[model samples]
Target: MTTTELINQIRKKKSFLCIGLDVDLNKIPQHLLKEEDPIFAFNKAIIDATHHLCVAYKPNTAFYEAYGLKGWKALEKTIKYLNEKYPEIFTIADAKRGDIGNTSTMYAQAFFEDLAFDSVTVAPYMGKDSVEPFLAFKNKHTILLALTSNAGAFDFQTKTVEGKELYKQVLDTSKTWENAENLMYVVGATKAEYLAEIRNIIPDSFLLVPGVGAQGGNLQDVCKYGMSENVGLLINSSRGIIYASSGEDFAAAAASKAEALQKEMAVELG
Candidate 1:
């Protein structure tokens, strides 16, 4: 989806929430295990229950890839279901896939073409060639990793490079790429304080922020610093929403969690 379309959905839904479909079989309610494709069944229920409360759904590839071919089939089914049933909701393949040019092209095809995801997370370590192939696709987005919430992010992202933090350099350098306008970035909500600085570098680019909810990143702080006129943020909540309850009432429970967040977002938007 284009940035305009995404922002429209956020406004219409009164939310910029991105529900992370990071399904872990072990963690899902045991009742779903009885289904033909437990993973897809769980996802379908969650999506149906909560799609209206959020603007985007992100299925991290590792959750599916770990199950091998069966898992991949589940991923395909989930995306197909979303495309057919809720096409207006933005879809993200949180694959974090990046490689040499040729390899990256295949990765892009897998998510953007074959599976039909609107966007995918990409690592920038391989530089332009690795990310351009993903950006080359029309109407598809490449969300590059910037300042992540993980403790290990300090290992490199915050380090000074020519007197600028490496994350800032990533944001600065990426804007020069061909089709750079298609780029969105990943900024962890835990590092909400840095968003003011991040906005200074790219005031208009959308950011796919994770580390909210289960990761304990504060929503109020994220909005205070990260939001632009367009609500250029997709704050993600994975375990906190999807796993809100492990019993038969899971989907309803998930909806409740999502509704609470959406309500808060509505206040922020107001």
Candidate 2:
């Protein structure tokens, strides 16, 4: 989906919430295991229950890869279900993939063309050549990893490379790449204090923030510092929402969690 289309959905839904479908068999309701395809079954139920409460759904690729072929197939079915049923809700493949130029192109094709995700997260450690390939795709976004919320983030992202922080340099250098307009970024909600300076570098770009709820990132602080004129944020909550319950009412429980966030987001938007 294009930026305008995504923004419109945010406006229509009164939310910029991005639900993370990082399903783990151990964490999901055991009853779902009886289904022919438990992974997709779980995802479909969650989507049906909470579709109207959020504007995006992100399925981190690692979750599917862990279960091998069956997991992969479930991911395919999940994305297909979203595209066919609720095309307006933006989809993100949280793959964090980055490699040599040729490999990056193939990775891009896998997520953008084959799986048909609207966006995919990528690491910027390999620099422009590794990332520009993903950005080349029309209307498909390459969400670069910037200031992450992980404890180890300070090891590299915040370290000074020359005079500026490494993450800031990534943001500045990325703007010169081809099709930079299609770029979004991963800025962890836990690092909300750094957002003001990060925003100064790319004020108009969208940020896929993933440290809220279970990770202890405050919604109000993130919005206070990171929000752009277009409300450029996709706040993600994974274990907190999806694992709200491990019973038959899991989907309804997930919806309740999502609705609470959406209401907070509505207030933030106002």
Candidate 1: worst 10 consecutive residues by lDDT? 208-217
Off by over 4 Å in 2: none
**CA lDDT scores, all candidates in order:** 0.95, 0.96
Give the per-residue lDDT of model 1 (tens digit) for 141-196. 99999999999999999999998999999999999999999999999999999999
Error of 2 at 159 (Å): 0.3
What are the per-residue Cα lDDT tens digits for candidate 2 across 1-270?
A: 899999999999999999999999999999999999999999999999999999999999999999999999999999999999999989999999999999999999999999999999999999999999999999999999999989999999999988999999999999999999999999999999999999999999999999998999999999999999999999999998999999999999999999999999999999
Question: Best lDDT goes to which candidate?
Answer: 2
Tell me how far the alpha carbon of residue 239 in candidate 1 is from the true structure, in angstroms, after superposition: 0.3
TM-score of each: 0.99, 0.99
